[model samples]
Target: MEEKKRSGAARYCTVPSCKNNSVRNEGYSFFSFPKQTDRALIRFTRVNYYLLKWERRNMTLPKVFVDIVAKHPHKVAFYFEDDIWSFQRVDEYSNRVANFFLSEGYQRGDCVALLLESRPEYICLWLGLSKIGVKAALINTNLTGDSLVHSIEVAGSKAVVFGSDFKNALKDIQPKIVNLKKYQFNENIWLSPPLFDDAKDLRTCLKEAAMDAVTEHIAKGNLKDHILYIYTSGTTGLPKAAVITNVRYMVMAVGLNKMVAVQNNDCIYDSLPLYHTAGGIVGTGQALLCGGTVAIRKKFSATNFWKDCVKYRCTIAQYIGETCRYLLAADDKNLVKHNVRAMFGNGLKAQIWKPFAEKFGIKEIFEFYGATESNSNLVNIDSTVGAVGFVPFYARFLYPVSLVQCDEVTGEPLRDVNGRYITCGENEPGVLIGKISTLRAVNQFTGYADKVATEKKILRDVFNEGDMYFNTGDILMYDDFGYFYFKDRTGDTFRWKGENVSTSEIEAVISDIAHLSDAVVYGVEVPGAEGKAGMAAIVDQTRSLDLEQFAEGLRKHLPVYAQPIFIRLMDSVELTGTFKLIKRDLVVEGFNIDIVKDDIFFYDVKTKRFVPLTRELYELIMKGEISCPDNFD
Candidate 1:
């Protein structure tokens, strides 16, 4: 392998180990070692080195932002709907935010909940709060009622600052959050006061606040101090607040910047919600840390996705798996030629990988895999179709990530006769884990704010007695070429007909065959069934799903054991802010015709067609009278 000097990327060679001095020497010849190698590890080391530099300089996110502002004061920081915010303007706005909060006697370590959509001000609010050492709990705007209240309560937010658009949501939870100081920001001049008597006019307060730069004395904190509390999607229950320190944020932001080779002039088109890690930190950080301009969107629109990219002259774009599917399914009229050369995000399924790349005219697809709080991160720099990331067999120890055999139902690591966790071999699906090390910030696990919830994600005594690893709660398999592919979520896999059924795999097959953009697969309970039976909820708003064709596709593409026993035709599938499918509701409403208003069908093996799951058929399944297809051969 020849060493290529990429801007913002570290020099790395094909040396088997990092200790090799030959590769470090200048003008050393680089050649392939026949073993698969990953350049991402080199990028990880460079990020680690940068973190060390920040530590030495006593730097934090706010400090770094101020530095960037000083260097590029006139550069456009963000582009919103017909509005461009310069770095100097953002700096001044954040300073006013810090000054106002500081004058209000808000002290260090205090949590302030922020409920706002994706916009330039959203970043400024959190950045300003962090400047004064106040942690901002980035609340999901879509959350309401108990979930909203729980997110705020979990973070112990002393104050809640929200946009006027979300005043109603705040009003609904105001009674529950009695101690919270509410501040409503109306984008337009408020003709009337806030709906609540206690809510203050934040826009007025910010206007009166001073714009003097907040000194280092006020924003004093180590890199380890928590700067933001980003909540989880709350798919199962209430969302858990994940603690993000300055070093952790830098690792996510700068790591991606170097890996994807984002230049200072590069404009990132970010349509994802800012509350999530992908859009909030990684996407926005490109502008703040890398001096690039970010084009923020209120929400993702498949119809307007490419248009915004072309409008902003965006050189880079961001997406998730669902976003890609929607764009692919969108009308060709919405498609347009754009300058987007590189796209980065997770959940780009292999089935649509090539088509998405070709259709969008994107050259590089930086598909990656990792949870919001997990230390085990992987990026597919090679663009191998469907591979989330690659960690060579020889480089596993260096990366400190491994696939260990785990129980599909519990997602717990399985122990051998020697009481040690078993490591999965090549092509064997297992849970991914990253070793928790305190030596480096990149490898350190800065878990959720909930200690018990945090402890649950850490597995102790994995391969050694005292060693610990962060459980990613994801099943993955690696090939001989060191390419790793995502299998399914740990609990998402269920045993059926003495064989394991991967919901992700089944969902992909169903979606591809039905020409549907959205499909969710889960296991449902059946009386006298040894294990949960496969059930699929596919979005078919027009009710145009051809049963005969769908059944024939399933029979040909999927094994009988993996086939969905029940098919649901839903008008729409509910998704999280990041476009992740919400499976809890569908799983809870499992094939119950009375509770579920959507059309349901049963796979009749004899006729090889999905028939209407009426009250008669529902009762037979409940009574364990109907036989499920176990084998077609």
Candidate 2:
């Protein structure tokens, strides 16, 4: 007997009385079962017709989830830690949660604050609230003190429900919440403080309520109604609540599935925090809408990531750039043992893109560029290595996105003699702006709950009078090939020696140096200086910075003014829950050795190496006794 090779094309059945074929396409090889009997043909035809109708219907977020539950009632919907919840089971649980809220006199259109970790219950509550037309303000679990109280109060939340892990944080702000009901989940995990004695136990309430579907309330929901209030990351300032309507979420949920070609058998691994848009909307929503499974974790763990993916049979995964970097740094041999074929999310740097994909065995990288509140959205569907997204000429008319020239110092749009903003040419880095109009529904910017903050993001009279555009506050470059590449944030790009300096560009150079785990570049004000000077905070994994080698690398790769004048060496970098670098404190501290305890070094002109910044040299530089190179002024 001889072994046979698999066929790539359709193979016709050779049975004596059968005329069936098997086809291979889109990574799927399936046999087309014969419909020889009349009953079989009728059943297939009816099912196909219904599926077409369902696809054509205009769906909201809640409707999408409900339809998935109806289609795959017994299919596992969520895998959290050691527990599994089926679609039908989660649906039933959400109904009980909704009933419990209604019993407490909570009416439709009410807003509730959600301060919980990534868990199955957090999702159930969010869905239940949406079913009843109530908005859920997703508070960042890492926030505490004034920031925590401001988030709940600013959203006008009628109630606040938190996980047991956040009990202590909630207790500190309980007295200041004023007239709002407080609730806690998983009370068995930890006891609430005595200060929160009045807080209701949501777990007990759900267990006591009937598992009945709130069909009437769900049916009353409008597609345009507010469903979620996701907050900004607050790296620049205080976090603001961004409104997420049902229609917006629907677009994300369905659009991601279509762009990524998600299937019913797929299981998505989502270790990103649930409070963020990537995890909540793209990760969780895509899975639910496709009738797939979601494997969630308390938080991202580089050591346990591949193990969980293999255990849950995950075919897709979500990531941020920092998470991918951590995975690359980890020494786990099980990295290539999983079944993940695709990875989706934003912030995957150009330098790390190809290596991350190849090492992880991911064939597709669905990188996207968008803000939580902004209307602008772009996705790279073809796995364009370094590009965030592609804006084809045909689709540009519909998106209304443009790149405009910006002033480096003011971080504002540059205007010509007519006071009209100038649009950047191809390959020019500029601020990304999306035209705002009621006619272009997809380009609509609902903005933040804070009306003042909402107005601040709008840039009027750009190309023409009476025209308005939403400022993305991000600098990007558009190439001739119709691909958009991220440059840096507006404030992140600073002026030095009459030229604009991109922190991201410099960070990329620093990241290429061996023994350096991470680097954060920013601008710092110098005494008697015209513009801010470049500075960097670096994490040296080797605990010893070879100044000569590091300086040589920077001098060769970076321009004179782009090179950092000062460097702070640290063991680790502080990051937000979503893996965004926390730069506020570092920027404030600057290179002041008195304020910053970290070891600081200054680039010496004669030695061509970085040396310790003693107090004598620091004062001389401040007093004009020492001059920096390229100080044209």
The residue pairs found clashing in candidate 2 are: none
TM-score of each candidate structure, all chains considered together: 0.75, 0.71
lDDT of 2 by residue, 1-633 (tens): 011113212111221111233222221112332221222234323433433444356446678788888888999999998889999988998888899998888888899999888988888898998888889999877666656787898898999998777887776766787588988786344554333567887887899998888888887877678989998732234467898987667556666676556777899999988988888888888655667799999878888888999999999999876577667766866465889888888777666777677777777788888878877777765566667776654446646799999975445799999999999988899999999976534667888888988988899999999999999888898765456888766655665553446676677678776446488888887764545688999987565778789899777656576789899988898665523236656878988878987889998877888889999988988885775655211
| TM-score of candidate 2 against the unseen true structure | 0.71
Report the C-alpha lDDT of model 1 over 1-633, residue by residue, as the tens digit.
Answer: 223323101222211121232222222123443222436556656766777898788788888888889998999999998989999999999999999999999989999999977888889998998888999999977666666788899998999988888887777766798878988877666375444668888888999999998886445767888999987532243568999999889888988888767787789999888988899999999987778899999888887888999889999999876578668877899988899988999877666777777787787788888767979888876566777887666666667899999875456689999888899987899999999999877788999988988998899988889999998888899765566888866555665543445677677677778989798888887764545689998888888988898988776656566779899888887675523236766777898888998889998988888899989998998886886775311
lDDT to native, each model = 0.79, 0.75
Give per-residue lDDT, candidate 2, residue 107: 85
In model 1, state the lDDT of residue 70.
90
Which 10 successive residues of model 1 have the least lDDT summed?
7-16
Tell me the deviation in Å of residue 260 in model 2: 2.2
lDDT of 1: 0.79
